[model samples]
Target: MDTSKATGNNAPRNLTKGEATRRRILDAARKVFSENPYHAASVRMVGKAGGFDHPIIHYYFPKKAGLFECVMEEHVVEFRTFMEHWFDGLDAYTTDKGLAVFIERIIAFHIANKDLFRTLMQNTAHVENFDQFPASAQYEVFHDSFLKTFRKKVHHNASDEEVSKFVYSFTVLAANYLGASSTYARFLGMEGECDAYWDWVKETIHYLFLPRMEKIIFDSESK
Candidate 1:
């Protein structure tokens, strides 16, 4: 399946020569951290991956911790944009438009940038446990935004306590479904195929969320 255009999916661009080099270094660091454990990733390795002579990461970033922090910052911005789009798109999800767009966006992201997605979502534990985690602040911001938006969405259906329950349940279900793709691929039957998976995600969102949301809002308004 189209391996082309795959290599640079995680890379960030748009910079002057100096800024370009710095961006490349950050991309390299993200690549390395996603493949191996973040604790095991090295600045020298990241620098070399970006076609540098030596530990030039030190030149661009003072310490490995700082470099990792930059990587985390980049991811935080990405999450912000993604969440913004997700929220905006909700307005577009209508009786006519359907949930296909929303499902496709999430599934496409999961497949295209699996490593980046995994690193950001999976490394929550690492950030939580580290005493002096460099990326903690960045994650906290995104986490807050996610919860705020999530709470708003759920409160449209349930009480405060119920909204909290739905938030936790919804997030857990989304995470489990997205994260288990590798396993799901093997035995998901027909829906495991990428195209079919998109269909499946659409159906899940429609069946699990939209019916209840419509009942609570649209159905109420109509009544």
Candidate 2:
């Protein structure tokens, strides 16, 4: 809270002091959490990175868990926007086009916000982020869209329990990969190239994963 601590354009307090301070803290936290994962992130460090004193961090987030919740809340909003914009007409989708778009959108979201997703995965510990994430409008958007679309598609072929398990498996696979991606970067050999990541995910989604999963889910009884 000390005016003396902030430097440069972050000088002291700006007009929207509260919002600016919150943004700065979140930005700093994103950087730290991205590099260190959830466990290593510290309030004091995020505060200092934001050009503020330690007390300010506590004043905003109260606890490390609370800060983590904020970060997830922000990202869930961004992700929900992407989903709603892309996953429209879920009821109309009977072909692979919808599923393909859904998968691509999710993968793109993961790539674009790898830092935030990394933090979330480390903290979530193989849980559905929606399960552990605090209740928010953003959560509602994602939860509803995903559940509705999934339930619709798998309705005739599988029981509700089966569908639920399937969804959990799917989410866990993606979340776990995102969590452990740093360790696999060399095999991925992306070297921080977004293109490489996309290429890998694109192939994984379409040729490798989609057809096989579709048959297992939609064609099991026919065979």
Candidate 3:
């Protein structure tokens, strides 16, 4: 019998040397790709950042596109796990509180994964054939998972289109705001005051978007 299909071995295991090396290369690639557009980034740049020879990087990811795809898929998986846990927590909350929790946790996530977010945004804009990329499927999974969680926890009565609009609007607002953190901080005269900048982000969301979101969620519930 094939025991490989069993869940008994699902316990955490340490990375092998090769796995560790690959992780290092992916990390370096993520940082490099985050800083530069895909066209401007190179495997050599990733090698320098990761302290590996370019050939080693090639061995792990023969094509730069493949490396980018791995990086995106890794980030998407991380985000999906986060969303699942986050939605689990929201199950016990009222919609108003759920919205607040959603905003707060999402901001924290954006701040934590800012680099991945930047890479995704930059490459998405520059990659003319993004729809054809293998990573695009991972993005679709992430999107579907997100919408599923949102519907399950926040608005069960909402249509996918309605939920998508809410999700899209919130993501656009949050991503652009957090992605340009420095510029937003400087423009607001809160430069060097990171706490103040984040606080302002929360305030801005509450004042600008939260009420409309609450209305929508409640409207969906009432319907």
Candidate 4:
């Protein structure tokens, strides 16, 4: 084997000790936080999960809140990137067609980041100073990006605030439906029936919001 050749351009770069440790801690903390709510999660739990001591964890993250914020910041960037990719590729010429595709993309996005979705949904109400997190700022960026993509698809002109409200309503519904799937399944008795559950979601939107959405997409007189 040519060991020296292995270190050429195709070779993987190595992380510094501090970077490696921080990565490990972040990975462990993400899992721990995903499985438990924020109030229930602790720095010690993250440290133990990553096979590090209190000092090591503290050296990287001085506070549990800060550590959680870091995890959100990292994961939300990935989320926004996923959204941008889909938004950029949108080719639908009509609002309804574009929305149909966007709905499917939203479902896939939540499924791909189920862990982060669960963590964020579970911890949102419990955390203090929630608006100060980096994820909040990143969220605004993606929110505008979503609106910009959606705007071109609308049949009629709608104010940004109006479009924002309409989009936010559906997004929250999708988030809760998937983020708390277990509860919905158990309570609704749709266990092991993922397709049916999703169909119900679509049906709900179609029946309840379709009229309002139509008005927004087609009614030019609406102000």
Candidate 5:
């Protein structure tokens, strides 16, 4: 309701009762979207999930699209903060060790937030007009800086194209693995062993992928 407090810098501050209600609606929207496809998720569902009246949700977000956008914005803010914290000590470890640690943290984060990641991957994979979403701009800004930071850690001989491909491939692999962990676990006869599956993933990446990557990077540099 208060446009003055809606600015990026001022938002999410100590909220009045009304703003708190808005927050609840957004939180509910997130869960609803995560659990359902975009076409199936509805304002009424979000209202029921949040335990608020439909009118309250409409007052904050006039349409389902608006509510989805707000939910995405909130997720983007939270994810950016998490990534910044995760990359805090990037320079401290050896390159291979640092990358292995980074990958482990990423897997851990995905496992912890599997539903959210599933929603994101599904939306991006299915929505043809994904660029029109409000979160696209935020993602572009975050992605540019993310690649820049990754480039700095990579071997200087690695081309931008190579780095881009690496990032894209790694993201897809991690997201898909965590998002479909349950299905994969069942298929592999390890149903309900989510903890063990995650450990195996981390170890596989650390002992196998990390060594291969180190060799590739150094090999390229030597060439």
Candidate 6:
């Protein structure tokens, strides 16, 4: 069988109409999954959101899992591109600036795709074994590069396991913040504008988390 043409990112490019319908379903699925747990989300709901019949969803994605997998695959592609661009210039920044940039980019991406991030986080929390997923394999390459940069710039003594834990924690923290922006705004008695909240988050990460990590690195080195 003939394959689709490759896009700039090397993924198989879909034809115009096929791509449009696929994106519609994917967008609807993302909203559904973000709002409802994986088990609770239904193809009918996705169809309704996309203004299509359930049969269309079934045509594009034989099962809900297949649709979810496509969502993850798309996210992996975008994320890998983002990481590649960020990592390429990471060495140019000082430790403080590097951390700031990292936090900023992470938060920005999460906010831009808040629903998708929420869905991914929910899947991660419920799924027992992510290793079986092909998307996870692709992500591991970026993860390794991130760890290499982390070790080179900040914590030379930190093992891969330790760095992985830190990366996981940082990502979860950022994702949760973006996922619960309205709730946090209410708690803080602040305006609900995302730009303002993002500014506050960046400052908090820079001043609070960044300093604490830097201090820990300093203390460890002094030992």
Per-residue alpha-carbon lDDT of candidate 6 for residues 29-110, written as tens digits (9 for 90 to 100): 8788777767677999999988998898888899887887777667666665555444445447665776677677677666
Clashing residue pairs in candidate 4 (N, C-alpha, C atoms within 3 angstroms): none
| Rank order (by lDDT, best first) | 3, 5, 4, 6, 1, 2
Name the lDDT of candidate 3.
0.71
- For model 1, the stretches where C-alpha displacement exceeds 4 angstroms are 1-14, 89-100, 111-115, 125-131, 150-157, 187-193, 201-223
**All candidates: CA RMSD (Å):** 5.3, 9.0, 7.0, 7.9, 6.9, 7.1
| C-alpha lDDT of residue 76 in model 3 | 77
Give per-residue CA lDDT, model 3, range 1-223, as digits (tens). Answer: 1111111222235989998889889889889977888889999999999987889998889999899889888777677766665654564666666666666776677666777567666656666786876577776776677767777766445566877887777766776677667777899988643878877887787677656665666565434
lDDT of 3 at 40: 90
| Ranking 1 against 6 by lDDT, winner | 6
User: Of the candidates numbered 5 and 6, which has the greater TM-score value?
Assistant: 5
lDDT of 2 at 94: 53
Best by lDDT: 3
Cα lDDT of all candidates, in order?
A: 0.61, 0.60, 0.71, 0.66, 0.66, 0.65
- lDDT comparison, 5 vs 6, better candidate: 5
Candidate 6 TM-score, true structure as reference: 0.73
Candidate No. with top TM-score: 3
**Model 5 agreement with the true structure over 125-192: per-residue lDDT tens digits:** 66667677646665565466566666664554666687677666666666566656776667767855
* Candidate 2, residue 66: lDDT: 80
The parts of candidate 3 lying over 4 Å away from their true place are 1-13, 91-95, 220-223
lDDT of 3 at 8: 20
TM-scores for candidates 1 onward, in order: 0.70, 0.68, 0.82, 0.74, 0.78, 0.73
Lowest summed lDDT across 10 adjacent residues in model 6 is found at 1-10
Provide the lowest-lDDT 10-residue window in model 3: 1-10
Between prediction 1 and prediction 2, which has the larger TM-score?
A: 1
Steric collisions counted per model: 0, 0, 0, 0, 0, 0
Model 5 TM-score relative to the real fold: 0.78
